[model samples]
Target: MQAHAVIDHITGWLKDYHATAHSKGFVVGVSGGVDSAVVSILAARTGLPTLLLEMPIRQKEDQRERALAHIEDLKQRFPNVKAISVDLTPSFNTFAETVEVDESEYPAKQLALANARSRLRMMTLYYYGQLNGFLVTGTGNKVEDFGVGFFTKYGDGGVDISPIGDLLKTQVYELAAELEVIESIQKAQPTDGLWDTDRTDEQQMGATYPELEWAMSVHGWNRPEDFEGRQREVLEIYTRLNQAMQHKINPIPVCEIPLKLLNGS
Candidate 1:
């Protein structure tokens, strides 16, 4: 998909955007995933400083190693790239203990904990970005960001700019190949890297990225007369995701007078 041209376009966009905003460069959270890797490279190509931060909270060893490996690779390729590692396990443990309610009765706190991890990472990125006058570059692709709402509201979604948000999942791979992303990260299962259990994105989304893309591309969300079983399933999954994430998609709720107060007001 003309990877070089696409990369050049994104890099140029970053350069212009940074200058217009009077910012120094980009600050990216490198999770050793393909999306982040590609975004980091694009940021590096701008000839501006790029800070790659690895904030792992109860992270798996392999994930941590891959993250460091990718950071080193970026440093070698981009002279302006500097990396910093901060393990958030201790902080997360403290917060979890401080807020853990009865799991037997209030059993949904684990999900909140996962979301907290993302928010913590966001706080770090924003702090560094603001300190150095850099923008926090988000790694979410199109299907995840728009189609499926596969990001925490103020967590992974909390970024100053999103370079790859327009690209589809398959398009990201094409760009990744051109950018020479780490082989392991490119091949690794796609995960949000949020949960303590290491759950993949497919598991959390109830469908693969490609499947979600297909649903998004379908004819106006219409169920055709003839459809394969999995195709229909994708439609259902996509619809359900959209229904459940309306709050995230449309975050600011309108304030209206209640029915009882409307007449008096």
Candidate 2:
């Protein structure tokens, strides 16, 4: 991957898009993850007003610290970069209380609430974006956004534009290194940061990003029988997720009415 060229292209694309949309700047949710770090820097590189929001809903201490550090680093490096720290714990708690479910369905309820956290952040990002006439930028990388469909629909998936959606997980790290992203975030484990428990993306997905990447590349033609042990296991994991997440991966379905039915006498 031509890291420097890719950076230039993405930075140029951002500026052009901003001009085309007639927007003032970009707004990104900084989660202390490599993908978000890379995106924030890229947006900052455009020399346009960029707002980095740290909306924490009971976020982990390390994660929150990393986000704060990155935001501060960018603010120091770029004059146009601004930072906002919004604590959404109270908002999330209220919403959770309003939608409380029975203990019998605790497992399902937990998943729903986790996803709600993401949706709340999405709303917060848009609030700032609209307030400042800036585009809401997504931090999802290709592997999570497209390959496995690991992101939450209409939640983390809700954004005006996904600048790094075309790059794989490993490639995102490459870009992060090239862009001089903070060492802590670059070396930290990749996570969705949606659950209360310290669960990394690999733990939830049952496979590492590298394993999933290989499976995604060859799943169309490769069969489990051709591989052995871990390879077969990873392939199965990837295939199952890729199939189960099709709804998130594909465009929303719309029903089309027949012209004759509409014009019926």
Candidate 3:
């Protein structure tokens, strides 16, 4: 489908979801990244009161400044969307201290930490949503969520609604461009910003989004019969992520056990 149609489809979907749920509005976390930027714009255009949250950790001066600036810019364009900033460093540090596992045992500790930040931000959103009446809007795209299972299960993955869950990374960028998000963020490297200085999402995933996106379109995860070597490797990664994060995609497992015997035998 074309990018314009995709954006309209997602916007309509979100509007329908809100109407059915009787939500007062929408809440979106803005990470100074393209995905969230596009989502914020989409939410605002839906005519629902949207909230853009900036939850920063012990980020560098430059990073924090940029994040705040992005929030301010959104505030100007989206008067109905309230932009707020909250520092989450103390909470994350406390959570880290409470966990017993060493960093080596979990090479992805940084990712875990980042997930904690995401989750905390979600919790904050929920609290505000409760008081103000709004549903939490997820910023995850299909590429990040499906290709590498990059989201933190209950953390970033927890949401009342996901407007861009089905769009690939490339598609998301295209939509962002159409939405006219700031050039810097639209062209910035994608990162979860979990640690002081961390590798980009592509770096950690071991494959760039463009390459993985192509493989996904061609193979569709389960791996076709013709793939070989590196192609097979990429397929495996994608399949593992899809399978591993299946729980996040579907929170409840389906049970098919019989409640009672046909004749009470």
Candidate 4:
């Protein structure tokens, strides 16, 4: 795990991709978490103009402070990095008040509002990307992106390409250390930051990142043929999480040809 090599690889990827796409720069939404911080630095290292937005919609002060601090540090290090702070709380409030929904559908209303926050952030990032001829970069790691589908579909999940999507949660931490990301962000708990439920990632996922990474590395969507007690329990937890997030993990359903089509009806 040579951190320097990993950094070079990711930076090179961004540079090449930007040149190939003929984009002016990159747009990244920083959440002050390890994953986003790493992505922001990687994008900045490309030497292309990069826009970092701290879009906080009713975000906790701790989260917003960390994000701002990270942006300030990264800007000092990278001349091409530009930072902006946008408060979306007012916009969110307007939307929440305007939209009519039945509170009886508890889960529906809660999740919808949460996802709306993410979508609003996503839209803001794209607006900057398009206006400045830059590509939007996503900050999802492998454990969250594929294993558990921890991101909102077409929200944070929407991007031109994922640089670290191949790396697991543990691996992202490794990269964070290698990239010299701010200590506060590196040590901060991971969160989607879409809601003020005050719940951490582990609380919501029902498993810590280390445990999830282990499950992904060991079982990986496959049933454990022989395991006992805690081992089996972990496997079961992985199965349940994978199943629950199948909609996000596998969003598009396959379509098959009908018999009528085969017969040239």
Candidate 5:
């Protein structure tokens, strides 16, 4: 299906969900990125009372400014929508100080810290939702959520509704184009904005998005193709991530015995 059609279908789903649940509206996190921008637009277009939260922590001034700009634009587009900004630096720092680790574990520790920030933002969303009668909207796309398990288990992954989980990263950009998001965000590289450093999602994935998308589209999702070099690499990464985070995706397994009789009956 075309990207626009996909957006329309998802928006329709959101509308139906709202009608069925009798919800007050939807809440979305605006990360100053294309995925969130598209999600915010869809939520607003559905005529829901959308809330956009920009949670920044130790990020560059430009990053926060861009996020605020996107939120402002969303406000203008959807007059009924409300936008708010919250600085999460204090909470993030407290969490970081509490987690003890060795100096050798740099990136891993940093990743855990970043995931904490994401989870904190999610918590904030739910707190506000409970107070205002809204459902939290997830901004993760299929490429990030499924391809490499690229989200914190209970952090950014936690949400009441996911509108873009079925679309690939490339398709997300297409939807952003259809939604007329800011040109900068529409063309910008995807990042987690976890630290002061400039880190691209593709860099962490160790492969270009087209390459990863093609692999996942073909072999991972069974899109018909010969499994070869790059395809093999993609499969390796996918398998590793899948196995590594299997526990996170599934409920805890408990041993069950069929027909256990109490009191030796």
Candidate 6:
């Protein structure tokens, strides 16, 4: 991809969108991942009042350091940029304490809590967004947002505009390099940081972004029978996830009343 062109296009698009929305600026949750790093820079490039939020809930040290470093870097480079760190660990603990679950439902409870972490961050971002008239800028990429539906519904998926949602994971790294994103973040493994353990996205998803990208490309046009070995495995993983996450990928279902019923026919 033409990195420079894409960056310029996104920056301009953000500026135009902000003006149209009549909002004060952009608000982004910086997670020290490549996706968020690229997006925060793009938002800063617009020269609007961009707020970078570092809301950590039991975050790892390395991740926290990288996030702070990126925030400082942006503050130094852009006068319109403001950074804040809100520790949500206590809040999360309290929430966990209040919720009750059976031992048999351990797996579901763990997954629910993980998703709740994302939702907590989302709520924090919007809290500041409303306070500052800033739009909640999303940092999701094409692969996560559309390919496999890897994001949490109404959680990290909540946002006013997704500046980098069109770019693939590889393209996101390309843009990160072009934008001079901090070396630490660019080098770190891609993670959602929702769980306590530092599990990389690949480990959790059972497929690398590049592998998933290939599957996404030929999902409809090709079938698993056409491939062999690991190719088939990756395709199956992609297909299964895509099918399971349709609720997140598609619009919410709404039941419409029949016209005859409404007319009392």
lDDT, each prediction = 0.89, 0.93, 0.79, 0.87, 0.82, 0.94
Among the numbered candidates, top TM-score falls to 6
Query: How well does candidate 4 match the true structure in TM-score terms?
Result: 0.92
Error of 6 at 39 (Å): 0.4
lDDT of 3: 0.79
> Which residue pairs in candidate 5 have backbone atoms (N, alpha carbon, C) closer than 3 angstroms, thus clashing?
none
146-236 per-residue lDDT for model 3 (tens digits) = 7567888777788888889888888889998888878878778888776677668877777778867876786553564567788777776
Task: Return the number of clashes found in candidate 6.
Answer: 0
lDDT of 2: 0.93
Writing each residue's lDDT as its tens digit, candidate 6 over 1-265 gives 8999999999999999999999999999999899999999999999989999999999998999999999999999999999989999999999999996885957698889999999999999999999999999999999999989989988999999999999899999999999999999989999999999878999999999999999999998988888999999999999999999889978788999999999999
Q: Tell how far residue 252 is off in model 1, in angstroms.
A: 1.0
Model 5: per-residue Cα lDDT at residue 183: 85
Candidate 3 segments exceeding 4 Å error: 60-62, 100-111, 220-225, 228-232, 254-265
Ranked by TM-score from best down, the candidates are: 6, 2, 1, 4, 5, 3
lDDT tens digits, residue span 1-265, model 1 = 8989999999999999999999988999999788998999999989899999999998988888889999999899889999999888999899899987997887878888889999999999999998999999999999888887888999999999999999999899999999999999889998888887979989888899888888889836486334778888888888788777767767687898798897785
Error of 1 at 233 (Å): 0.8
For each candidate in turn, give its C-alpha RMSD to the true structure in angstroms. Answer: 2.8, 1.0, 3.0, 2.3, 2.7, 0.9
Residue-level error in angstroms, candidate 6, position 154: 0.6
> In model 3, which range of ten residues has the least summed lDDT?
218-227
Query: Any idea what lDDT model 1 has?
Result: 0.89
Judge candidate 1 at residue 143 and give its lDDT: 86
Give the winner by lDDT: 1 or 6. 6
Give the poorly placed runs of model 4, Cα more than 4 Å off.
Answer: 220-225, 254-265
